[model samples]
Target: MIAKIMGVLNVTPDSFSDGGQHFDIADAIQKAQCLIDQGADIIDIGGESTRPDAKPVSFKDELVRVIPVIKTLAETTDVPISIDTSKPEVMLQAVESGASMINDVCALRVNGALETASELGVDVCLMHMQGVPKNMQLSPVYDEVIEDIKHFFAGRIEACISAGISESKLILDPGFGFGKTYEHNLEILRCFDEFKSFGLPLLAGMSRKTMIGQMLGDRDVSTRVTGSVAGAIIAVQNGADIVRVHDVEETKDGLMVLGSVS
Candidate 1:
């Protein structure tokens, strides 16, 4: 099993979770080191906000927000850094600045993003998100979530392969809450095993999301730790290769127990 933990390292001051906490360079570096010590196999650094109905950040703003942080983290840790961006320029700059992976929400459809990641020789994770960030959850509709996302992944993977991206340098993520309704999210989560048809490592990122909040009806994000770990465990049991999470210590402990009992 490709068991691994991806720590959320947000450089944005407005992220849905842990925002503004790491906006300071010193704080971000400390948090990065702390996460590494806490057992994060990978550190995913993102500068932009992809929360529901979020506004877009400019390229210059994103670069300024992320480059220094990426450089700092890269120099300070041996863990691989994945740039969570959809912009081609951002990917190019991020990879050049030390990001070893491209964890795009848009799956490289933003013009030159595909070409850039293909040339960078780093890992790329193609994800399935319905619609754009600004309006994805605006009464989104799907005839069938599983089949639709599978099609999206197939097309994106084919495009990446055709664009000269290596086969071994790719991963897949079924973006859980990006554009899904409460029922849609749960359905996708429960039927996650159906995604195995794609034949690629799956990444699960359902930590502290709206779906969980809506599931429990009245839990705050901070208090959603149990729900998040439960979702992560379900994802693992369903065939996830990696899980991107925020509650690193709890998630690690949960996985250890799950492994032991298995």
Candidate 2:
């Protein structure tokens, strides 16, 4: 099957990429529509910036940032909406406002999050971050990256099941760049398929990330689109079921060519 493209919409002023680009309600709605028109299969909206060294937003602030956009899109479009947050309150509100999925960097490890996700009954993407965003990159260490992530997923999956979440509702993400060094990120991509051992859909999100920048001789974020597309294609080739990306149209075009050749 062709990998689905999940478009990123950050409604924050300090995101690593495109921050302040869609902080307004109208602007956020417009961006979501643009992503839909660009062939995005899923629209993942985030009110908080989980970028390294990023400060946290209060629950009220995050809700104010994302709910109006989600409500408007739910009323305007038929596209699936995914809330990119780990806060249980935000997850509950987003789903109520029309988000059909939860993309949590913390993998529902936050207090009350696992219970909230289980109750919401929406698809959940559990990402593996070695540590919190504020200091995750300081010195990320794992005996074996791939095996360690797999082990993490196994424990999270069990916890989700124990919390009354269906196994089928779970999606796995290796949390590229969240706490990984450049070498760690590359190693994850090289062995990304190993994540499929869980028998669940795998999501690969490496769009305009530092890894791509480092691979391209430390290119700036704006110039890393081509490299990001290449990473998406490679992930798909290695069995990624979905790719979370910022450049939806470019990734779609790359996937089209890949599909034709394969």
Candidate 3:
């Protein structure tokens, strides 16, 4: 099957790539609609930045940032909505406000998150981050990156199952840049298909990330589109079921060419 495209909609003022650009509710809605028009299969709305060394926003603030956009988008579009948050309260309210999926960088490890996700009964994308955003990139070490991530996924899958969440309702993300050095990110993409052993959908989100920038000789975020699209295509060719990206149109174009040839 062709890989699905998940458009990123960050409503925070400090998101790495497109912050402040969509902080206004009106702009956020406009951007969401634009992504839908650009062939996005899902819209992943995030309030918190989650960029390295980023400060956390309170759940109250997060709700205020995302709920209205979620509500409006739910009412306006048929595309699925995914809330990018780990707060149980935000998850609960966002679902009530019409979010159908939870994309948690914390992978439901936050207190009450597993229980809340189970109760909500929505699709959850459990991402592997070596550490919290504030300090994750300071220095990330893994005995063996792929094996270590697999181990983490195993434990989290068990935790979700124990919390009454169905195995089918889960998706996995290797967390491309969350806590990885350039080499780790490359290895993950090179051996991405290994993750498919879990029998769950895999998401690859490396759009305009530091790794892409680094590979392109320290290109600025705005100049990383080509590299980001290349990464998305590689991930899709390997095993990515969904690619979370800021440049939805470009990624979709690349995937179309890939689908036609492959």
Candidate 2 local Cα displacement, residue 148, angstroms: 0.6
lDDT of each: 0.88, 0.96, 0.97
How does candidate 3 score on lDDT?
0.97
Tens digit per residue, CA lDDT, model 2, 75-159: 9999999999999999999999999999999999999999999999999999999889999999999999999999999999999
lDDT, candidate 3, 1-262, per-residue tens? 3999999999999999998999999999999999999999999999999999999999999999999999999999999999999999999999999999999999999999999999999999999999899999999999999999999999999999999999999999999988999999999999999999999999999999999999999999999999999999999999999999999999999999999999
Score candidate 3 by TM-score against the native.
0.99
Which candidate would rank higher by lDDT, 1 or 3?
3
lDDT of 2 at 86: 93
Residue 139, candidate 1: alpha-carbon lDDT: 89
Q: TM-score, each model?
A: 0.97, 0.99, 0.99
Q: Whole-model lDDT, candidate 2?
A: 0.96
Top of the candidates by lDDT: 3
- Candidate 1 residue lDDT tens string, 1-262: 2368999988888888788888887788788888989999999988898998788999898898888988988887789998999998899999898999999999999989988988898999888888998999998889988888888988888899999998789899989988888888898889998888877888999999988877778688888889998899999989888999988888998899889877
Cα error, candidate 1, residue 44 (Å) = 0.5
When 1 and 2 are scored with lDDT, the better candidate is 2
